[model samples]
Target: MVDRDRDKAAESRRILERISREADTGGASLVSRATKRARNHVSATDADQDDWIEQWGTRIGRVLGLAICVGLLVWLVMFLLRGA
Candidate 1:
């Protein structure tokens, strides 16, 4: 029973480690793919097209994030000015 418990713990630790690595590496891959897409203006192949779409999506996300941040800042300023 003790050996079985140790084996289970070891397996769980490995699974957790794998998940951590994937999460850390996945973001880099996405960023690199997006950068590659940005560099290629003309995508003659399907993969290029896919990367372009991903980059476009990332660009739009950045824009939206900026807009939200600006809006929040404006709202905070107004609230402070109003003494709310």
Candidate 2:
């Protein structure tokens, strides 16, 4: 019975080692494939700055427009309250 238990433990260890090796190989392959794909991908470096500038300009315009609208509303309210 003791020998049987020892054999079972040894078998389990062997199976675990094999699984570990297989996982290592598969993980390496996946990483290499992902790296290769990333290397082949064309990142948009040229348009990054242009996109940022355009977005910033749009935001500034929106803020300015909002400020003007709020100012006009406030002025109109004050004028109406002043009875002309």
Best by lDDT: 1
Candidate 1, residue 2: how far the Cα is off, in Å: 55
C-alpha lDDT of all candidate models, in order: 0.73, 0.72
Residues 1-84, model 2: lDDT tens digits: 999999999999999999988677554677798877544332323234568776566556666776799999999999999999
Candidate 1 backbone collisions, by pair: none
Instruction: Go through the candidates in order and give the clash count of each.
Output: 0, 0
What TM-score against the true fold does each predicted structure earn? 0.41, 0.41
For residues 1-84, could you state the per-residue lDDT of candidate 1 as single tens digits? 999999999999999999998678555678787778654532323233557777666666666776799999999999999987
> How many backbone clashes can be found in candidate 2?
0
lDDT of 1: 0.73
